[model samples]
Target: MKKNTLTFIFAVGALIFFSQLSAQENPLSVGFKAGTGLSNYRLSGDMKSFTSKMSIGGSVGGFVKYDLSSNFALQSGIDLYYSTSKLDSKVDKSSNKLKSLGVEIPLYGIVQGKLGSGKAFIGAGPYVGYGISMKSNGVNLFKNSNEAGKLVMNRFDYGLGGIAGYDFDKNWQINASYQLGIADLLKGKGGSMKNHGISVGIAYKF
Candidate 1:
């Protein structure tokens, strides 16, 4: 029994050591990640102050990384982003919720370094999103808001984001990021509503 236990321990140690070595040698990788997180927009308009609740949201996506040197790489990907937030107004006695579905593309300039048996990285860059659909309280907000039936939101959104992460092994990693919307979503309205949120997720490399 003691011999069998010793063998198992050695095997685990060997597996970890080799995994680290393999990661160091590889300069390029592709991976997929999926996770849920909290989301809320930077509100505007007269009722913007009433926005209080953050909605739960998530993304499923894949990324590609290409090393530029020992300490830098370019990372980019497409992610399916879904987010919602709740708005309540006491003065008007109104409660409403906003939801959006979009596809996002991000290009990050990442700096990577070795951290003990793993690797760590930090990145920041610009991102763009195109909305697939948007709604408020089960009503299509993209539809006519005026008597002429014109769209209210500009479908394109652009932002900046920062990310930091650690890769535990060649195949597993965890990351967190924050995004700030730079472009207004309002078509021609005076008020400004922008997207901004943070996300944490796990990724697997192939």
Candidate 2:
């Protein structure tokens, strides 16, 4: 009877050691994700009176994440975003429309917690963007001008963002996030641009 008990203990120790080794062998995970993003720009201070409306547009991007532990990781990616807004002037009788194209890069560190069958994660990071092009369309509201030139927006912008996501398994996830701009995208000091959106996509771990 004593010999049988000693053998059982030895078997349990071996099982635990092998399980730990298997986990270490698969520590790194990589995946691809793409989804639609809704973007809008907000004006600040006195500029709010002139541009009361915010623009809404779509964005898509791909990302790569490296797992640092079971509950933490670091991720980085690139995205293309489009946005448009309408400006109505109370003083003038007409309105103007603006469209902008932007490229953004984000670096984030994430912390995760497991809940039943799904895992939830939260992340915060900084992002930088460059405006590639901008155009204005509409009737000229300025009193002296018959036509308006193409809109020139600030090329460089920076912001902070927060993200929350849930993973159903190792290969699938959905997320929602908010981003606030700290730098002005418009050439002058008129206003700063802000964006918020939700996205759902599939991720494959390798």
Candidate 3:
């Protein structure tokens, strides 16, 4: 319920932003992109006191973009991403790390402006991801109280994202973006954990 509400709000907000910024329609373009991402988990609710270190990962994907006007466009893409995080506690003498891989889909509403002879774009939207693999290394503080579980994370992840980029030419683009997770990653959790991160990459349109 909370996850659905947040996703819906983000989608609607992107639509409203796009509608107001669109000016002239342009043709569609397809592109490929690859980049590195840095991520970490934010534990909230009952787990607010927990601490985690940032994770480093990479993403490779393809995207399609349709220009709503000369200055606005909509973009969607699919990417395979790898994420990891290290967890620790101050009061409790325990430590753990999580590693996961997933597929992500992002729907971004973009606004473009002239930058000298090139173009600059900024986009924001919502993204949803499904974990292909996830595991944790630490004591299974729940079941055995000494053994780690095989898989400890939920499959679905949803959040809000924002991206900004510049086109150096008709074919090359450089961009950076961030994802703020709203859904809890742990399934049947004693607490809540969410993934959030930033990515910087390059893209080529062909």
Candidate 4:
């Protein structure tokens, strides 16, 4: 119920967000993008005492953008990303390095302006994600715990994202982005774990 509520709020919030920011409509464009992402796990709620280190991974995606005008646009896309980060506990003598692959659906409102002849853009939005794979030390993290018989991690991840970049040409773009995850990763609830990610990538419009 909590996860559903959060996703609903974000969906509604995104609609309201762009409706206000975009005044005029322009043409639509489609693009392909690839990049590297650095991610780390954040402990929260009952799991606040834990720690994790950042990991580098790959991201590939395609997007369609609706030009609200030369000054603003709305973008949506499907991104596939991977991450491997170490999670540890101070009180418990345990350390785990998790690797996961996930897909994200993002909706963003982009603000565009001129920078030295090229166009610069900054945007903020929300994303919905689903994990296709998650493992720690050769063990599946999404499976049931051997001793507890409860699921170890949740596959559903939803969050807010921000991005900024420059368009060197009508068909080319370079960008940096960050995603702050809001959903708890723990499935059956002994605690909470969330994800934070930073990515840099390039895009080619079609």
Strongest candidate by TM-score: 4
Model 1, 46-69: lDDT tens digits are 436466478899999999998766
Q: Pairing residues by index, what is the TM-score of model 4?
A: 0.83
Error in Å for residue 40 of model 1? 1.2
What lDDT does candidate 3 reach at residue 19?
Answer: 72
Clashes of each: 0, 0, 2, 0
Q: Give the TM-score of candidate 1.
A: 0.81
- For residues 1-206, what per-residue lDDT tens digits would candidate 2 score against the true structure? 99999999999988876665566546556666555555555666544555536556666677877666667778888878776667665665456776667788888889988987989999999989887766666322212343343234567778888888888887788777677778765543545444434444445454
RMSD of every prediction: 13.0, 9.7, 9.2, 9.2
lDDT score, candidate 3, position 81: 90
lDDT of each: 0.84, 0.67, 0.82, 0.86
Please, what are the lDDT tens digits per residue for candidate 3 over residues 35-89?
Answer: 9988898887656666878978899999999887677789998999987777777
Off by over 4 Å in 4: 1-26, 148-151
- Residue-level lDDT for 196 in candidate 3: 84
Q: What is the alpha-carbon lDDT of model 2 when measured against the actual structure?
A: 0.67
Better-scoring candidate (TM-score), 1 or 3 = 1
lDDT, candidate 3, at 56: 87
